[model samples]
Target: MKYIVVKLGGSTLEQLPPTFYKNIVELHQSKEWSPIIVHGGGPLISSLLKSLQIETQFINGLRVTDQNVLDIVEMVLSGSVNKQIVRHLISAKGNAFGISGVDGGLLNSQPVEGAKELGFVGEVVDVNTDMIKEIIQKGYIPVISPIGIDENGQRYNINGDIAASAIASALGANLCLISDIPGIYIEKDNIKHTLKNITKAEVEAMIEDGQIFGGMIPKVKAAIDGLVHDVPEVSIINGLEVDSLIAYCNGEEIGTKIVLNKESSYVK
Candidate 1:
């Protein structure tokens, strides 16, 4: 069966319509493609951190997660965010099991290069593919929270995009980044046009030219990183559109597909 790893940003999850969840359930029930979800809860985490009067910081888009912040992060991600996604799936008549990277050591991680600055932030060292596969085999969609744990029992905050990329790589699945916008766009003569396809090199060039900026940088970077690690395909699509996820799986060309090489890209 074909597998697709869907990365749902916390910023967009709450705004996503019930039909989005229904489409996910439909995709899961289909004989062709199976859906696995990896989700983020940054907005909720930030709101909680703010309410608690805890100072938070970020460097290079990675949160500087101290012990206290890590506790809150885990609670929001593993507890609330993960279960919320599962509930959505269940409400749509889908069987979904929610788990964190810490569960069964699903994600083995180590401190990132700048861990001293970004405390408790980790990069995925390994993924428990067997455990994930077992969950899928049991007829349940795996809703994963991006929290990694090391051998020493220390949990780390992992970026949702990074975690999804790693999982997609491990499973050799297509990675779909669910975004609020239709796709990456470029401005020309005061008009913004969504790209049908983009290459890694082109993405880098766009970034260098300042055409792609802000939060989009991390998303494209994660897609490029996934391609480098052998994920067959990665696309950024708007979750708000009805059947967007299903359309993507059916190769309907609704979003910007990212590939490693120019030759691998379609001439759209």
Candidate 2:
């Protein structure tokens, strides 16, 4: 079976409409492709932290997850957002199971020792794809939360984008990142959407030209990483559009396709 890994950003999920969920249900019912969902809960976690009166900080756009903040991250990601995605998928008639990086030692990680201030923030060192494959084989979509456990058995908050990329690379599956905007734009305020089939070289040029900066930098990097790691292709599609995913997956020209230059000849 053709398998795809989708990473849904927390910002995109919060903005997702009912129609989007319905479309996902339809996609799940197709029986043509199997999908594994890795989701982020940054926005939700931030809100919860504020409600609990915790100060938040970021180092290089990654949250500096202190011990208290880590607690909130666990609660919101594994507890609320994970279950919500599962509930929505199940309601749409798709069999969905929610799991965390901590569950079954799915993702083993280590602290980013270079940054002393970012407490409990980790980078995924390894992933176990056996359980994921088993779940996919059973026709169940695995909804994953981006919470990793260190070798010392301490839970650490991981960046969702990194988590998704690691998982996709391990599974060697086509990866798609669903977000609120149409794929990476050449000019942020240009208003005219330019969905070019990009190569890693083009992405680097865009970054040098300041077109890709800030939040988009990491996202584009993740997509490029997937392409380089033999995943075949990775795409960035707008989550707000109900049929965006289906259109892209069907090669219907919906979003930006990031491909290695070696593979460009086959895209057309």
Candidate 3:
């Protein structure tokens, strides 16, 4: 069966309607394509940190996670946010299994390139697809939180988008990032135009030129990273659009498709 990894960003998850969960349930029951959900909880984490009088910092788009912050991250992402998504799926009449990367060694990770500056932040080195496959074989949608663990019993905060991309690449599945907007947009004169297709080089250039900033940097960077790891393609789609997931699966043009090569067809 074909697989699709759907990533829900924290900013957009609360605004998504019930229909979004219903569409996910439909996909689970359809047998045409199996869906795996990976989600983030940045806003919730930040809120909790604030309430606890903890200071949080971000370099680029990634959160700098020390041990204290990592604990809160785990408590929020794996504990509350993960269950919330599962509950929504269940309410939509779907069987959902929620897990974090730390569970069952699902995501074996290592410190990222800049470990000194970004404490406890990791990049996935390997994924345990066997557990994920078994979860899929049992006819349940797997909802994943991006908290990763290393060999030394150390936990790391994995970027949700990067985690989804890693899982998609490992499963040989397509990655779809759910965003508040339809796709990446650039302002020309007075009108903002959505990019139908983009390449890794173009994405980097856009970032360098300040066309893409803030949280978008990580999404596009994650897409490019997934492409580098052999994920067939990654699409950024708006979850607020009714049946947007279905539209993407139906081959309807609805979002930006990011590719590694310029020669690829972006129509689909």
Candidate 4:
């Protein structure tokens, strides 16, 4: 019953190496860790929209999806990216089943607070945890695409990180956010180094000091949210590295582990 939710960024999805797939297969076959993949296709979706002469817009990092855009999003995410991951895993001798939040109401959500401004963007309110757990227990790795739906059949595009966090939170599973970089970097003796373990307070202070900025903001924020939601573990790992996943599964720290708090010190 050891489950880990791996959130693959769009960049990782674009260049997921064969070793990565094989590693996932190994983890699944070993029965030590049940890995669930949640993936995004931002670049692919954007490219398709451009090719079709569609206008794409984003607000606060959330895509403003219209009806036509939603159609393409679903096609690229649930159809293309989802299957592609499954295909790669299957090719590596792994059993995988691709699905979306919209299918079987896996992620029931309502329009994000300001739906009028950011059309069709929803935040997950509920997750069908039982279904996902069942899929995993049945020996099928559940590869999820972050496309959610409301009760009235209105579909909304979800941020992949947020979607993964919600699912992991619901299942009380460990979450690994696959990032382009190795991990959180800190300057040590005039040289920058990655922090192996960190706490939310330390990360917040780093952000305040401008040490953590740019695209990494959302990731650290998501990690904090996962911790707040009672997820047992959360880490940011590099998807490009061949041994990252395996190393993590073996408990040989390969990324920045986000913990609820740091060790307390007694000030004399």
Please provide, for model 1 over 1-268, each residue's C-alpha lDDT reduced to its tens digit, 9 standing for 90 to 100.
Answer: 8999999998999999999999988988986888889999888999999999999887756778999999999999999999999999999999999999999999999998888899999889999999988999999999999999999999999999999999999999999999999998877678788888888988988889888876677778889999999999999999999889988887898889998776533222
Q: Give me the runs in candidate 1 sitting further than 4 Å from their true place.
A: 263-268
TM-scores of all models? 0.96, 0.90, 0.97, 0.91
Native RMSD of candidate 4 (Å): 3.0
Model 1 root mean square deviation, Cα atoms? 1.9
Better of 2 and 3 by lDDT: 3
lDDT (tens digit, per residue) of candidate 2 on 8-33: 99998878877666666666667777
Ranking by lDDT: 3, 1, 4, 2
Residue 102 lDDT, candidate 1, scale 0-100? 98
Q: What is the lDDT of residue 14 in candidate 1?
A: 91
Q: After best superposition, candidate 3 residue 187: deviation in angstroms?
A: 0.4
Give, for candidate 1, the lowest lDDT window spanning 10 residues.
259-268
Report the poorest 10 consecutive residues by lDDT, candidate 4.
Answer: 259-268
Candidate 4 has a TM-score of: 0.91
Candidate 4 residue lDDT tens string, 198-249: 8888888877888887556666877888899999989889988987998998
Which wins on lDDT, candidate 2 or candidate 4? 4
